[model samples]
Target: MGWIEKALMRANRWHFVHSYRTIIAREKRKHPQDRERALMGAIGAASRADFAAQGDAQVAVLRHHGLSDGMAVYDLGCGIGRTAQALLRDGWRGRYTGADILPELVDHLRAQCPGFTAIVQRKLAIAAPDATLDMVFHWSVFTHLYPEECFLYLQDIHRALKPGGRLIFSFLEFEDPAHHTVFQTRTANFAVNGWSSVLDSFLHRDWITLWARQIGFAPPRFTSGSDTADHPAFWQSLAVLDKPAPA
Candidate 1:
């Protein structure tokens, strides 16, 4: 299953490219046998699925923001296609594209459901061209991105979206001064693009809002409460951005 996990994770390579160093390596060390650790990992995955089933909050937020049936939707960094599956289950009767950086994930998705066109590609380099999609959703994807890479993807998102399209994403934020210094100095990997960094890149509401404006998006909304948002939870945020209507 190590190989399987590696392959599935590889599709979401950008997020894990040495970003999981401290965690995975530590697990391997603690459980040199790795069997016990693997079981724990399996449990964790099952728990995530259960949490999604109980209530896919992202779906609720998307629908509230204008998502509807038959819209061409792209689930970027779709790990194992859970959200994609949830979308289908949630009455999203649209042309769906689940794009990721790992071929293994697409393979698993295909093996599980051979209906949609799953593309193993980077979010910054989308499969469809400009103004092609009705909406683009990146649930928890941005939480894994480096600040620089996040900016790049925001630009890509601007180009990929159609006029009047919407883009939603979530990130980590430093709710207090204690987190500010951590995120600023930490470097998860040499690539300079990873989540293990100490800062709440997602939680830093101001910088993200300003950055979105730079990417042609209108102002962004954020906070740390019901319907607003908080941090360190399994999901740090659920940001929503929309494209302008054509002239």
Candidate 2:
């Protein structure tokens, strides 16, 4: 891209981030005491019922990807324990740790799901010790982050995962027709309404493959967003990366 195109992209990103922060501040002011509302707003969830349903579907996907008893799992950007709640309800006997940038969400997760560890993180790094986790997953987290930001987080996730450990994350890609709808919606919102908190970002498969190779992760496996028996409501694409075990 040319310098002019780069400048335009930067300006657009700034606008989206500013608009999103404004929306979050407004929600906090409007519902200072309503934890559920705050949590839903932060994660863009419509209702507890919908949240629970999605969480259950996510757990199904995780199970399909080899989630089982006694494994240590990390939930990055784990908003309000959506997957954690589902895992608990399904009687999953695993050490589950969740972390998010929002303290209120983390606190609510702790209150709602006892025995699970929740942390409020402000950086792109994971809080776990090196090579301690069996699995780490992000649901609708990378869709809002820039490519560089996503790469940094993946690097940290690699550090936190044990050899051969798997990492699963959902992202939006332009190759999928359905994902174009997300971009269209955000564009219309910004054009007509002048502001929208939604920062829908799309990633290319080549970019992910390159990042995985550069970070020493095993080749990534991609699952189409349309393949949705496990995570029916989520339309974002999924990528699975594994840390290579020593020879």
Candidate 3:
């Protein structure tokens, strides 16, 4: 299964790259006057409303986990600097490191947002030292990563976080019959970019919890409903996991 999945992923690499180009072209057409919106569209979030909602959710999770000024933060899949922009706009003095897989988008983010550090990272990895980051946030990242990539990224994130550091990520939780078609089609690795399709995805709460434990994290905490969100919206629910401090 592993080898077969790897082969398929390699075959689909072009599709992913083409998808970005296609998005950039379309977003440029749709928001010619607003480059920021166009860039957001290129990163799989073209709609400003949806982008704002997800960014807000990310900030809420950070604050809920005691995020404060001057703390070091690592944002994985930092699409268009949405979370970083929000954090800075709200006066978060924390050192921000925004990393993404897309180089073009990262270039745009770095050019536009000079306050935070941005990098284009490859190979499903975070470029930070062990026990270095105070918090790590991953929004809508796992939805596209293959299972193995997910595990590998989680391992890398675990290595970067300090003891008692908090890791917040969003996933497409397996729920309801509406997702049946996608699940039946893709099983573990499904992705059709720009089709509102949850690609390379499908996860359960227990599966995430088990993986967290195996990655040396404490028990995972799931937050849903209105506990953190200002308004009920179509954003991913957050899972807060912690690393154990010294004995």
Candidate 4:
């Protein structure tokens, strides 16, 4: 990391520790997805509200290209299986596998969403056969990884996907110059000892375009963020990494 970036990160950490303690390393996960939905409803309490607002913005992207039953979907960072549940609830007749790095989370989804497979994926690896996943989603997952890790995982995600398969994800990208700036961008208290508490916390914008090309992801579409910020760069991208060449 360059000196300025390192210094900026250090400054952010100090600010959080000295001032933003309450929000830093928060006591509880603020966004609560209704766990009950994992059992009965398609969306859980944690992200239902936002997903509701975006209007399943990600799913709409896929449907535009044609999404239907008989397809298989893999939720890469399937936290609490909220998105997975939502997809199924929408009468998306297809196979669903929700994978996350958390085993407890996998158990929750497995018990709650019967017939839904919750695979424990600790690293970037997708625990599926090559070219198995027909439709995949990282959801808000990439918003958490380090840029380098994001690149690696993107490749991994590509490997697990079938050629011509679709991969859906969102980015904290600076696709437009209208927005995407950090002011008083001090460290979120999710930092420890001047380091990040969450993996995706320190992300900037450039990584999006770089990683997309590295993974061979094809042309992408951008959707504006539904927030007051109104910064065009706070946009979410729905990209389909082109199918990899056969091994």
Span of 10 residues, lowest total lDDT, candidate 2: 13-22
User: CA lDDT of 86 in candidate 4?
Assistant: 61
Using lDDT as the measure, which candidate wins? Answer: 2
lDDT of 1 by residue, 47-88 (tens): 445635523565766676688887888878765566665676
lDDT for each residue of candidate 4 in 162-209, tens digit (9 for 90 to 100): 888877676555543432442113244324356444333333434555
Each model's Cα RMSD:
8.1, 4.4, 4.5, 7.8
Give one digit per residue, the lDDT tens place, for model 3 in 1-247. Answer: 7999999878676444455566678889999898878888766674888777667766866786789988999999887788877786677897889987778778776876787899877767789989999999888778776777788888998999999898988776656354465556664343444244335476778888899989999999886523434433324656888989999
lDDT of each: 0.64, 0.86, 0.76, 0.58
For each candidate in turn, the TM-score is 0.70, 0.85, 0.80, 0.66
- The C-alpha stretches of model 2 lying farther than 4 A from their native spots are 1-34, 192-197, 229-233
| Candidates 2 and 4 compared by lDDT, better number | 2
Q: Which scores better on TM-score, 2 or 3?
A: 2
Give the lowest summed-lDDT range of ten residues in model 3. Answer: 225-234
Backbone clashes in model 3, listed as residue pairs: 190-200
**Model 3 quality (TM-score):** 0.80
TM-score of 4: 0.66
